[model samples]
Target chain A: MAIKVAILGYGTVGEGVYKGIQNHQEQLIEKLGDAVEVAGILVRDPLKKRDVQPGTFITTRFEEILAIPGLHAVFEAIVGKEPGYTYLSQCIEKGCHVITANKVLFAKYGNELLKKSKQHGVHIGYEATTAGAVPIIRTLQELLKVNRVTRIQGILNGTSNFILTEMRANRLSFGEALKLAQDNGYAEANPENDVEGKDAACKLKILCQLAFGCTPDWEEVEVEGIAAITSGEVQKAEAEGFRYKHIADIRAEGGKLKASVKPIAVSSAHPLFSVEGVDNAITLETSLAGNLTLQGAGAGKFPTASAMLEDFSAILEKSLRTKIHLLSARVPV
Target chain B: MAIKVAILGYGTVGEGVYKGIQNHQEQLIEKLGDAVEVAGILVRDPLKKRDVQPGTFITTRFEEILAIPGLHAVFEAIVGKEPGYTYLSQCIEKGCHVITANKVLFAKYGNELLKKSKQHGVHIGYEATTAGAVPIIRTLQELLKVNRVTRIQGILNGTSNFILTEMRANRLSFGEALKLAQDNGYAEANPENDVEGKDAACKLKILCQLAFGCTPDWEEVEVEGIAAITSGEVQKAEAEGFRYKHIADIRAEGGKLKASVKPIAVSSAHPLFSVEGVDNAITLETSLAGNLTLQGAGAGKFPTASAMLEDFSAILEKSLRTKIHLLSARVPV
Candidate 1:
């Protein structure tokens, strides 16, 4: 048997998902016990020259993709909150699981969407929403079962960190570092979300809700971007044996949860002190597990696709309790 | 309905598992959709003083634990291989899922036992058998689905790492570091398995089997202990802007896997560079996700017990896809 899937965008992550399914179909089949087929792709312009699997349906209409029979999952990567959430909600209504890399939408509507998916007997995976390939969401979901998490600190935005790292490493001005990030394809043409701390704010909201089990008021989270951090300040921190990092921090202090996203100076011993480039790092301070730090590529085609694929694998594994990793039945001991 | 579980030992890990079950029953019920009760315990001496919940059965005999009504899972933390293997085998024969924290027994018998349990319509979880609380096993299981893992380097043994870090930071002799590790409860009195690199060898074998999909020949793994490192060597490495760490490395070289456990010098930017004390770290260089590193408490009661409980959560989650994290079914859009 083969599993049918769809994609909702034709950007970097969408292309990666399509390629990931095509290139690793054998592995997916081995692990999923079935071939995964990208049966349909929803793009804004069907006439655009895009690399797609031969004979797969390409359409600009979401209804055309949703009409596909036996669709198992949808990988969404569109850049907005409205249509993306609506398409995903529609997919859930049709009983197909949805996996996404859109944190902006999820941070706001994740509670409703997750609750809605449960009501529809479907799975929704957003591991790619925060830290691209870090698996923080799944880790928290598993750990929160038997542990009391005290605090969480993360370098959730890769662009901001990349800019900070560049400013410190090469003594580039903020505008120069931002230009370098754009030239290297690390930043979008309009890099407001990544530079202004809104991206990290959304990611923190999603992480905090999962880690603390409450939706915090967005207004209460203090937000500060690295735009105002001067080259001199970066050098000063370096001279003081510290590095400036755009950190998204959430902690419970005296029974109150405080959240912030800003540039902070950290010493050499910090887990994220050496985290450079466009990498993401997360530290979970839990009572039982002590401190756990996970680092991975914060944003990229393959990394985001990797998280979505993991979430898809999990959804399929749970759908039927498939014996992909289970060995054959043997005689009694 | 209440789920019944059993423990095969009553030492540090066993007591942690017991207390974890008692203390986190609320969270367990909230997550697993039913109360988790430690039904029975298999201890060496039944009369030994221990903290246990009232009305729970404690016995010296394995048969007594197997006799517990409605037993669902058995957590094994006994020392050595002989009886731990036999007892776990019996648990599988009785159609109960099994989780373990004994690496020595598992490194040898895991493949055979896992295959055997599959035939019995039961599950086997050994996350606690490797790095404590790191979740590397589960993370690898999920990532290996699509990502081609190229190499894995880990600080797998806490005692070895603790001693090495101490030797470097305090400029202590090998014997002095070993004594300090023992006093801190990081190393055992007879710490041959840890200091001699046998513990790391076992963990590396387990990780390689999962990542590479085939077990390498046990005799071919180049194992080197940390006992030979002098204080001068540690200082030399430090002076050269490097730290000597007990590293377990396995990478595919020219289509063949090379495995080794030894003291290696790593600079500041290395993922495991600042990993000090008893903290364990692992870096997986994957073809798709880039470099993913995870660090956490390497060896402890709560951490090890946390792994077992996560494994238990997975086992129960697979048994019946209860709506623990799922909300009430809602109307379609």
Candidate 2:
């Protein structure tokens, strides 16, 4: 039997997932021992000029795509809450696994989704939602099984990191770097989420939930973005043998977690000091394993798509026991 | 319901595994949804003064432990190949899963073990055999499922890295550094495997088998250890803003793999440049995910034991499908 999956949005990640599945069909089949077919693609505009695989149906109506028989997984790449959240919940309720790139929805309602998943016995894969290509979620889920976690910190946002990297490396001002990032498609026109640290804060909440098994309110996280950081400070930090990085940090002790996202100066000895450009790096401090660091592409189409595929493959093999990394009980502040 | 397991050879790793399992018993029980008990321990001296659980059984004979009922997994921590290999094979033949920290046995006979495991439908967990606490084996196994790995290079040996780090940071010669490493318990008295690069070569073979499903002869890999790295060269490289790192490299393209272990000069831009002390770091260049780097302690009693427990927890959940990351068929080389 072929594994049938649907893409919930026709955006960059959705298109990338479609293309990746199409391109690596044979290799995926070889590894999975079965053909994985894209059944339908849910789009707001069905007439949008897009490259799609043959026999793949495109529809604007969620009901049309959900009506497909034997849909094993739904790839949720749509933005914002509302319909994306509703579609994913319906998929899980119907016993279909969900793979998503929507960090905002996950950060907010992850705990609820996980409880629903546990009740329905379905997997929710959010690998693409956090660090794009970096498999930090899976790493934490697997390695932290036998180790006591102490601290989890990382450069989780690529847009903010990219802007900071441009400012420091090219001697550009924050505005100049922001402009460059926007021009290069690294930042959005309305880049409040990236500039004001909301993006990294959301990811930090997700990470803390996975690492410490505790959910933190996104509103309570002390967040400071890159917009307030000056090039002089960046240069001064560099001259003082330190690098300024936008970091999402969470420290856990006695089952309590404190989370923050801010522009932090780090010495050369720090792992996050070297993470630049659109790169993401996470350092995990554990009692047994010592300090472990994982670095990779923080965000992009292909990388995010590849992450989704990993989750898809794991779900297919019936190996993904942890349904939602971020979906657990919220710790009362 | 309870999952039962055993430990072979009550040495550093074996003892560490015991303590780790005992300390994380509650967490393991929660994760596995069942009580995981260490049923018996195989040792040369059962009466040796060691800290263990009150009800834990210890015996000097492997057959004694093997005769225990409901043994789900056996952890192999004994050094060398002979009786360890035979015991592991017998365990697999009897349909019990095996987890090992024996790198030599893995590099030498991984192919045969994998074939036997497949024939008997048993899992062979060797995450502890390479880069002890870093979880590189699991990372490669999970991440490479969706990405095409091109090149993998790393500082795989803790002793070599410790020596090189000491040689640079303290301006010590290779002999002085080796003495320091031994004094710190970082290197064994017979450090030939680490100092001659054979240990790294073995690890590289294991990594290659996991990454490319192919294994090159361990002896065939170009081996050059830090024994020849003088403090003069180290200072010279440092003065020129480069670091000399002993790297185990494997490149796969067009379904052919080339493996080598050598001391390479790396600039600050290189991910392996700042990896110091007993730390091990690996940089993987893939087709879709870009450059991914993972760093941590490559060897230690507690770290390697934690890796073993990870396998134990996975086996308890019956989620470990591909057990032997490196134990696979040899391609037509």
Candidate 3:
């Protein structure tokens, strides 16, 4: 049986997923025991004539993709909340499994979609929404099954991390670093989400939900980006045998969840201190497992798509099973 | 429904598994939706009174444990091969799921046991075999499904890592560090496996089996211990702003497998440079996900048992499923 899935956007991640599946077709089939095809792709401009496999369905209409016969899953790679939220909600309502890379949608509406997916008896995998393909989210889900996590701290924003690395290594000012990051396609034109710490907060919220089963009001978490940091501070920290890192720190202390994203001074002994460039790393302090840290690319086309493909494999395995169980209220299960 | 399991040893890892399961009984039930019990424990000296819950079964004979009616799973925490391998083989032959913390047995006979378990339609979880409680094996299984991992480098042996860290931080000689480690119970009296790099080789081979589906012959992989590393070399490396780390490296190049365990000098820019003491870390460089690193307490009573508990939960979930599929030739699925 050939598994059929749809792509909601033909952007970087969407293209990457398509190409990754094509590249690893043999490996995927070997693991899945069946072929998988991207049945339809919902792009903003279907007539744009992008490179796609022959007979690949491309449409601008969500209804057309939804109407595609035997579409078992939907991949949401579009950004922001409005259309993505509407599209994913409708997909879940239609009992379609979903894999998403939209962090904003997840941070704002994850709880709702998680419940909705459970209610509809479908899976929702958002592994790409947080730390690209680090598998932090899945690991957290595994840990939460048998252990209590005390704290989770990470470098969740790649743009900010890249800018920080540039500022430290090249002695560039914040503006210069931001401009360089933008030129390298690592940051957006406005870059508010990445630079103002909103991006990290979104990822942190998603991680908190997985690790602690608690999600903070996005607006309530304290967030301070690398905007206020100076090259002098970076140099001074280096001289003092410390490194300046933009860290997203969340801890459960006295039964309270406290989260903050800010530029913090970390010593040489700190794990996050060495994670430079567009990389992200997460440290999980748990009761039984002790402290476990996972580091990888925080965001990228290939990495994000790799994460989506992981979700696709999981969904395929579940669907192939003779029976499926809604084990918990959680959607990913 | 209730799940019945047995423990094959009453050592540190065995005791930790027993207590951890007892401690997290509610959590386990919530995740599994069924009560799971350690129905019997097979120890060498059952008459030597030890701390145990009231009504817990203790026996010196393996036959007694195997005879316990409806024993669904067996946990092998006993050291080395022989009886452990025989017990596991018998357990699988009897269609019982098995979870093992025995790395030597896994490194020696993992392929045989994996095939046997799959043929018998049972699971064999050895999460506690390599890199205790870090979830590396599970994460690798997840990654192998979607990504092409090119390289794996790890700090796998905690005793050697502890010695190296002590030699650097406390300026201790190799012998002094070994004595301190033995005094602190970090190293066994005959610490040849850990200090001679054989333990790490075993772990590396297991990881290779999971990550690459290629198990190198245990003796074929190059082995280099930290015994040859002196305090002078550690100081020189530190002076040059580098750290001497015992790294277990395995890479698939040109369609061939190359593996070695050696003490390597890593610059501060490297992720492994910051991993000190008994903490172990593995970095997987993949085609899609870039470099993914996982760091944690590699070996500890609680951590090893926590890894076992993870396997326990997985087996419970698998057993609860209505149908089981030997999806891949791989048994871990």
Candidate 4:
């Protein structure tokens, strides 16, 4: 039987998820041992033109998608905490697995959703929650099993990093860099979230949960944006043998999980210093493995969708019986 | 009932695995829902003075370790192909999950062992067979499900990278840098495998299997050692705005897998250029996620052990029941 799934929201991530499944359907089926069919997509307007398959069901109501017979999972890409949280909660309650790239919603309700998903006997995959396409989430899940995370420093926001790179590379002013980033489709219309470090902090929050298994007080987490970093400062830092990188630093101090997102001058010896453009890099200090760094695209249609699909593949792997079973199970027991 | 496991070979990786399990006992148990105990150690000399726990069993015979009742898994840290392959084969036939860091053995007999292990109803984990502690294997397993990898470039050998970095940074000759690397415990006494790029090629061969799902013929792989690199060339490359790095370049051409490990002059803008010292990095060009680079300690006692342990943890997670049982299973069936 086909593994029925749905897409929640019709934005970039949602569309990428759709295309990824459609394009990689054969590979997915080969790995999953079953065909995955997108039963429906929950979007704001069903009438709005989208790059969707003709046979795909598009609707504004979450209930309509939820009512799809034998729906196995939902990929939530909705913008906010509201409908995403409610829809995912309902999906879990109805016994459907969920995967999301929404850091804001996940950062706020991750612990609760994780608990709820556990309660419902379904998996909640948030690989797209941080460092898109870097594979940090699954890496952390594996490493943190037997290792204690000492420190996590991340360049989580691609927009901020892109702006900072432009400012330093071309001597562009903050306004010019931000405008260029927006023109390049790297930044959103209201750039406060990207420029003000909220996006990085949200990603950092999600990371802290996976790495340290501790959630910090949302209000206590210090956040500072890259908008204050001027061209003169960028040049001065360059002259002083450093680059201004917007870093989300999370570490445990005296048994308390503390996090801060701010612009920091990084030297050439540092890992994040080389992570240029819209690339996101995370340097993790671990108990067993020592220092490790992962760098990749932080945001994009295909990148973010790749993470969600990874989660989907993981879910499928867990649900499916071991493929090597013929050799093992053939021996009469 | 504790999860019973064994360590074959008392080398750096084996000793590290032993100590890692002992140190992270609580964390492992918490995550796995059961305690894990090292049942035996397969070593050449049981009388050898090692940092082994007092009650742990030490034996030179693989059969002795295999005889331990209820042995769930065996960590094969043994070097070379003979005993490692033969012993792992026996372990699999007996229904014991095997995790190994032996790239040479895995590169040679991995397909056979994997096939045999599946037939015997066990898992063969070789996370440490490639880039140690970089989490590339699991990451590729997730990403490769729905993505086609175009190219894989890696600084796979840390000793070669360290030698190159020393040659450039201190203006040392290849001989001097290799000596320095050996002194710093980065290069082995036989440095042939490391400096000659065999180690990196061995690792690259393994990575090719995971990323492209095809094994290249050994003779067809173009292998080049870093020993011929002169300090003058290194300095000249530096002057020309590039740094020479030992890279394992693997790509699919016309549906055939080709791999080469050689030192190439990489610019500052490149991901592998910034990777220095006893660190390994891999840049994978994915059809969906674009280019993603992962860098970490490729070889070390703790680092390599961490990879094996991560594989062990993954095995345990698959074997054990889900933790959130009350939430899902409590409903009326």
Candidate 5:
């Protein structure tokens, strides 16, 4: 049976997901022993010619995707809260599995959406919500099942990391670095989320939930972005034999989750100090594994899309099971 | 049907495998939906009276382990080339899945064993062979399946990392730091394998095999260690705003594999710089995923053991027809 999928946004990540799915079609088919196809793509501008295969049915309305017959899954690449939230909810309510790259949505409303997905008997995957391509979510949820995680720390935001790396390397001020990042396509025009630590804070919330099984309040996460740190401070830190890294830390201690996103003065010996440029790395300290770290491209078209493809694979596997658990009743927290 | 496992080598990593298997019993049951048990343990001293649970049949003989009726899997944690190699071959011949934590055996004899395992219709896993608990092998094999990997740069050995970290932070000489590492249980008495880059080189062979599907001649890999580095050089690099890191790099360029293991001057922009003290990190550059980095405890009882446990889980899943093809067959150049 061919699993039909609808992409909610035909942006960079969405296009990458489409391209990756097509490129690895043979291997994916061999792995799953089945076929998958992209049924429809929901684009804001249907007339916009994309780099993707031209025959892919493009639509402007969200309902057109939901209305597509035999749609088994939805890949939500649309960022922000309103329409992505509504579209994903509708898809889940209609019994379609959802694979999303929206960190803002998942961090804010994951608990709610997960609850709804459970009730509808579907799986909601947001692996691309954190590190672009690193399978940290699956690693924590599946592979590291027996391990009790103590702390989650790493470079979670790429734009901030890029800015910090630029500040440390080129001795550029935050503003100058931010401009360079924007010019390099590493940062969005309104780089508020990436600059103010909100991007990392959102990722921290998702990571904490998976590692600790506790959804931390985003507001409680102490955030200090790279915007506050001057080039002088970065140079001074180097002179003092320290590295300034934008670190997102979530510690599960004494039955409470304490989390923060900030620029920290890490000694040269610290693992976080070595993470440079726009790359993302996560160090997981667990009872069984001790300390494990994963690093990769935090955000990029291909990395994010590669993650989405994995989620697609997971959904395809789930579809093969006899008693499909699309939705389960929300467990009381 | 319950999948039975026999553990070979009752050392630190071996004990960790036992404890991890025991600790995650309930979760394993839930995930696998089957009963699993440790049928036997291969130990040098049967009467050592360690912290492991009672009733586990302990034996010093390879014949005894092979004789265990219905033994489905074997986890070999004994380090070295002789008995570990011989015993693992015996297990594969018996149609039992072989999971190993021995890097030397894998580096030298992986091809032969893999061929044998394929012929015998059994899987062989060596996730713990490199990077302790880090999932580099699996990441290369599974997560980045669609992407063509270009380069892999990592801090593959923890002992050398610890030594380098100490030399930089405390201004200790390489020899002095190595002494401290040995005293602190991070380095073996004969630390030549780690200090000379042989340990990392061996692990790099496995990484190259998975990442590029061609194992470069081990001798061709340019090897350099931190032994030649001094506190003065570390300070000199610091003065120039660069950090010294021991890095193993393998890249596929124009149908040829270029590999190297050395201590390089890394700017604050490289992901390998954040990897510190006994922790390992691998940065993979792929066509689809761009660049992805994974970091973790490169070596430790629990971390390595956690990897072995994952292999055990893989064995159980394979038994139930959920064959996880984490690695493709190495294509000979």
Candidate 6:
């Protein structure tokens, strides 16, 4: 049985997903024991020449995907709200397992989407929505099932980490570093989400949900961007034998969850101090596992897409079974 | 259906696995949909009053586990080669899924054991053999299935990392740090295996097998312990805007694998440079994902046991269908 997958969006991550799936087709088929084929691609501009190889069935119309017969799964790589979120909801409703790299959707409407996914008996995996390549969500949901989670502290945003690392190394100002990040394609043109901690906050919400089973109120999360921290502060922290890192922290206490995304002074003693420049590190403290840390690329074309591939593989595994109880519940704010 | 499991050694990791299994019983049953019960425990002295819960059977005989009718899997946490390796081989031959935290066994006899395991139709998992809480084995096995790994470098040993961390922070010599590590239960009184890079080398060999499909020749691997690195070198590295880290480097070039355990001068720009103290970090450079780094406690009772539980859950999941394939093959030394 060949699993037919349709990709929604033809952006960087979307293209990476396509290219990666093509590059490892034989190996993936061997692992899957069933062939996986990309049947259709829903892109903004279907006629645009992509650098990488994309299959023939490309379309600008979103409905073309929903109408495509035998599409077992949908890979949503579209950014922001509107059509991406709306289309994903419809995909789950139409009995398609969804793998998304959209943090904004998961952060805002994860509970709703999860509920719908369960009702439709489909899975909504957002592993790429948080940390690009790291399997933090799976680690918490599966591996740490037998452990009680205490806290999650992480350097979740790579752009901010890059800027901070540049400041620590080249003494570059925030603006200059931001420009460099933009040039390197690490930061968006506006760069508000990555720099202002919105991106990290969205990831923090997902982490809180997975680790504590509580969806944190995004607005309530105290966020401090790296824009405020100066080169002098970086030098001062260095002199004081500390490193400044933008950290997202979530802790569960007395059945209540508290989460924050802010810059913290990590000494030579802490693990996060060692994570520099566009790398994300997550420290999870569990009763059984003690303190476990996972670090990787927070965001990159192939890294983010690679995470989606993991989710895709997982969906294929679960879809082979007759029944899958996808958790969907309304988490109160 | 319930899966019956046996513990081969009632040591620190074994005890932790026992306690974690009992503590997370509800969650495990919920996630796996199978109740895992400890059927037997192998111990040196059956009469030794251990702090195990009542109702668990204890035995000194190795054949007892193999004879158990419902035994589906075995957890081997026993240290050293004497009976641990021999007993594990027996269990695999009897068609029992084996999960071991013994790096030495895997490093030396992994190829032989894996071949036997494949013939018996059982899976062999040693996620705990590397970084205890870190999911490097599974990450490489599952997540990077489609991607070709280029380079693997990290601080693979916790005891050595602790000693180096102490040496840098306290400005203590290597000997003094080793003494402190011993007193703090971080290192053994005879810490030659850890301090001499043998433990890390063993772990590196297993990782090489997974990453490159070639078993690293332990004799061919260049080993450099922290015994020679002085506090002066640590200070010098720090002054030169770098950090001295004991790194395990493995690279595959032109179908040839080169591996070494040595002290490397890591600049502030390197992700591993910030890993301090007893923390361990592994960086994998892949064709698709670029550089992905994971940091965590490389070894500890709870962390290592956590890896075992993960293996246990994975085995239970696979046992549902009784579909197990031996994926390890003997490579020429």
Docking class of 6: acceptable
CAPRI-style docking class of model 4 based on DockQ: acceptable
lDDT of 2 by residue, B1-333 (tens): 677889999899999888888788788878876777889999897668988878789988888888889788999999998888999999998888899999999988888998998899788889998988888888887656877889999899989999988888899999999999999998999999999998998888888888888776656668898788889999999999998999999987566777889998889888788888898889999877778899888888888988888877766555432322112211211
Q: Chain B TM-score in candidate 2, rounded to 2 decimals?
A: 0.93
Q: What is the lDDT of residue B321 in candidate 3?
A: 61
DockQ of each: 0.38, 0.38, 0.44, 0.46, 0.30, 0.30
Q: Give candidate 6 regions above 4 Å deviation.
A: A1-3, A33-37, A52-55, A217-219, A230-234, A320-333, B1-3, B33-36, B119-121, B216-218, B230-232, B321-333
lDDT of 5 by residue, B1-333 (tens): 776888999888888888888877886787677667888899998778888667778888889999999988898989799898899898999999999999999988999999999999888888899998888887776566556678999899899999888888788898899999999999999999998888898898888887766877766678997788889999899889788898999888788888899999998667676566788888888776777777788888888988877767765665554332211111111
Task: List the candidates ranked by lDDT, beginning with the highest.
Answer: 1, 4, 3, 2, 6, 5
Which candidate ranks first by TM-score, i.e. highest? 4
In candidate 3, what are the lDDT values of residues A103-157, reduced to their tens digit? Answer: 9999889999999999998999999999998888888775447887888989999
Off by over 4 Å in 2: A53-56, A319-333, B45-48, B53-56, B217-219, B319-333
Model 1: per-residue Cα lDDT over B53-141, one tens digit each: 67779888889898888899999989999799999999999999999998989888989999999899888988888889898998887
TM-score of chain A of each: 0.95, 0.93, 0.94, 0.95, 0.94, 0.94
Model 1, residue A270: displacement in angstroms? Answer: 2.9
lDDT of 6 at B73: 89
lDDT of 6 by residue, B244-293 (tens): 88899999877778889988888866768767777677989987767888
Candidates in order have lDDT scores of: 0.88, 0.85, 0.87, 0.87, 0.83, 0.83
lDDT of 5 at B233: 95
Question: How many steric overlaps are in each model, in order?
Answer: 4, 0, 0, 1, 19, 3
For every candidate structure, what is the RMSD over all alpha carbons to the true structure, in angstroms? Answer: 4.3, 7.0, 4.6, 3.2, 6.7, 6.6
lDDT of 5 by residue, A200-252 (tens): 88898888887777766766668887788989999999899888888989897
